[model samples]
Target: MPMNLLHRMLCRSALWERTSATRIVPWALTGLDLGAAALEIGPGYGANVRTLASRTGALTGLEIDPGLAARLRDRHGADMTAVEGDGAAMPLPDSAFDAVVCFTMLHHVPSAAVQDAVFAEALRVLRPGGVFAGSDGLDSRGFRLLHVGDTCVPVPPDTAAERLTRAGFTDVDIETGTTSFRFRARRPAA
Candidate 1:
């Protein structure tokens, strides 16, 4: 499904802003080098761009929504580039970025297979020793209600570290909160 008005509002709300700033951003950036290049997959409203841009030497966003991607290009034009693309099958080059991160959109993928594909793609794009990190809502009743029919297969934090490891990542770490979880892992060094 496309990004509707309700989704846009939710992404831009104060609660969303705080959550991204405090919990998500810090966790995702846990072990990343601020001077390295980074890419964010499925950035619904580019909510994570500002923080990521401020830290990373170069930043790009891969958004599924063409219109939203264009808007992101306009809004954060100087800080980063925003391209329209799919997470499971990106058009990007291999080992191009020092880091790859995603927000709560993994569950929005059509299937668990696609979600796993996204993790593999994320690992594939990371340079050796680079980070692949992100956060997502827990499969709680509230989260399910909010996402409604949009969520495909919610990945609980308990399984995230293993998933990352299976996708060729190392040093996997996952922190689960009451209704959300953050994860970070690194591609093996050469």
Candidate 2:
């Protein structure tokens, strides 16, 4: 099976963990208000969707896999809107979301160009001063291989902050302590 096909299948499994409340709660406490309308890239199993929806007024999930998108739709219904699309080329307009969240989907995206495009899209859709945070399995001493279908990518942290900085995000902060690295960035207020 192709890697994309495997991701599609995994998106349906409820076992996949979502956002880390322990990590997110502190960020929220620091005055990053997520007002309403958040956009989540690759919300596998609707974990982040549940977390975002609980805090924000509305949430939208963009997923490349139809199976996962459909499962999310069936599970979330009207509370969270799930759309089938690529993160690198989102259909929404600029500054469309109060915040943008991408979690555990970077390694699966092949090529640096695609990563740039996705980061650009995330920055484009976010409101000024809006928060953008995500976690990716990066290069660590105990790095493990995550088999997403037929493709296996390095589950180690890459240059996510540099990518975000190039995309015009400011105040970029990255934390890489555990097996995964979490990135928290802010869009400069205009």
Candidate 3:
């Protein structure tokens, strides 16, 4: 997932980190227990990982960008695992995680089919009864401007539930906010 220079800079900025830590992640995770092991599909500059690592006992970040993934591994190696991989086709084992999350990054996946593949992969990697939750910005003029020269495919909140259900998720939930949408779904325990 390639990002424009401005987008890349913003992701690595202090403001982005602060907002992600204080607002976005907290809002998405309300009432949800991430459990012992959690996997983040696209940690980007790891702004969310800082918060996620504190909540879960063991955390893993699977990033598509090799450089970002390497940096994450170098910086958070002691506290978390960082793997360079695609969300649509994870290099992880089935039922290996207690939770899987992605935030503000799915739009970079290039297409709806890939996004659905990511959804399915998230379900596959979760332990039965595991959770998948995250947030992404809605399509807007501002959002579009921020993604110029990038692969931007915003996932409409309206259609997310159906996509999740089709991916074999249960209890699918999507909540649209002022500028973004948050979602959560569960893998049935039975």
Candidate 4:
């Protein structure tokens, strides 16, 4: 389901901006070049698209919410492609992207199995040696209250990397903070 107005506002709020997760997650993904074809799984409100666009030669995003996807396309359509699509079952061609990114949205996946499928899908869409990077919020009372009415599952510390490894990602590195976890994992070269 699409986020309501309140949820949308909060996702794009200063409160969300100030979080350490927002500041540090990108760092964990450093060194693996974002390359020409980059994809972000859930770019809410198009805030990071500008920064990412500067780094990537071409950028595309898959967003679950049709309304938000339309808004993103309208706002950044010249440089980025924003489409309404499912993360776990993206329609993109295999090995099409050089990098895949997500942010603060893994918890929204309904189940661990589904989340793993999403990870596998990221691997499927990535070209050889491409990087998959992201951060998801840790389970917390405050964050939960803020995201009330959504099915949120904070990945336990140290488990995300293991799951990514199981999903065929190597060189998996996961970093944990008080409120969230970020990771960078790569598909092996051909």
Candidate 5:
């Protein structure tokens, strides 16, 4: 997904990191345990990576952009693994992680079909009973403005549960705020 200059700048800002640490990450991962191994679908600018790394035993960030992936590896390789890959078709092993998550990056997948593929991939890579959770910006004026020249196809919260279910996840839950939405679901142990 291509992000405009302003959007890129905003994502890399200190304010974004603070918000991710104090609010977004907390809300997205509430009441869930990431366990020993966790995978982050898209770790843009590592805004949420620091908090995520602290909570899980090991964190692997799957980034679509090669440059960003390299940068992440360079900056946080000691703490987390950063691999260049797509969320819809992750280059990881099946049933390999205790948790898989993405944050504010779904809409960048270009279309709903691709987003669903990402969901399926998440399920495929997670261990039974593993959690798949994330948060994304809802359609809003500010959100639209922020994505001016970027690939933005907002996910409708109303249909998220169904989509997650179709992707073979159970206990799907979605919560929408004024500007964003959070979703949590788990792969059935049986």
Candidate 6:
């Protein structure tokens, strides 16, 4: 079935929050020490991009939706560089970002392999010792109201950790709250 306007707006809002909230607080708490450059995949409405841009030395936002990407660029102006692109195949080179953040975009990727590709791309762009963090709603009774692109993605903590490990991230940390599962993983320092 086609999504109504309200559903579309809700999905977009949730996506923005899922991708931004998980990282924002932790980043702020850690003093936003992300190095020279950072990247946010599927930045949705650019909430994460705004925060990261303010904290990091430089920030890039990649969004598949042209409309949203344009809006992000306009909104963020010089604080961030917005790109129209796919997360699975990023336009940036390996180790381009000191940190990579992805919100609730994995499940909307449509296939497990694509999700893996996105995760791998995130790892590829991250510098050694860099961090990647994301959050998504879990399929708990309380979170039944949570939605991602019209459906729920059951993001269990263990499964998210496994995925991060498979994507070459070490020191995986998974945290769960009442409504969401948050995963933070780091690339090893050489």
Q: Give the Å shift of residue 68 in candidate 5.
A: 0.2
Model 4: residues with Cα > 4 Å off, grouped in runs = 1-5, 14-25
Q: Is candidate 1 or candidate 6 better by lDDT?
A: 1
Whole-model alpha-carbon lDDT for candidate 4: 0.83
> After aligning candidate 6 to the native by TM-score, how far in Å is the CA of 143 from where it should be?
5.1
TM-scores for all predictions? 0.91, 0.81, 0.99, 0.90, 0.98, 0.81
Task: Looking at model 6, report the run of 10 residues with the lowest lDDT sum.
Answer: 144-153
Count steric clashes of candidate 5: 0
TM-score of 1: 0.91
Error of 2 at 35 (Å): 2.1
| Residue 177's lDDT in candidate 3 | 97
In order, candidate lDDTs are: 0.80, 0.72, 0.94, 0.83, 0.93, 0.72
Instruction: Please write out the lDDT profile of model 5 over residues 33-96, one tens digit for every residue.
Output: 9999999988988888789999999999999999899889888888789989999999999999
Estimate the TM-score for candidate 6: 0.81
Tell me which of candidates 4 and 6 scores higher on lDDT.
4
Tens digits of per-residue lDDT for model 3 on 1-190? Answer: 8888999999999999999999999999999999999999999888887799999999999999999999998888887799999999999999999999989998999999999999999999999999999999999999999999999999999999999999999999999999999999999896
Lowest summed lDDT across 10 adjacent residues in model 3 is found at 71-80
Task: Residues 59-92, candidate 6: write the lDDT tens digits.
Answer: 8988888888899888876888899999988988
Quote the lDDT for 184 in model 1: 82
lDDT of 2 by residue, 101-187 (tens): 876677677667787888889989999988887777665334333353443344334466677899999998877755567777888
**10 residues in a row with least lDDT, candidate 2:** 143-152
Better of 1 and 2 by TM-score: 1
lDDT of prediction 1: 0.80
What clash pairs does model 4 have? none
Order the candidates by lDDT, highest first — what do you get?
Answer: 3, 5, 4, 1, 2, 6
The residue pairs found clashing in candidate 3 are: none
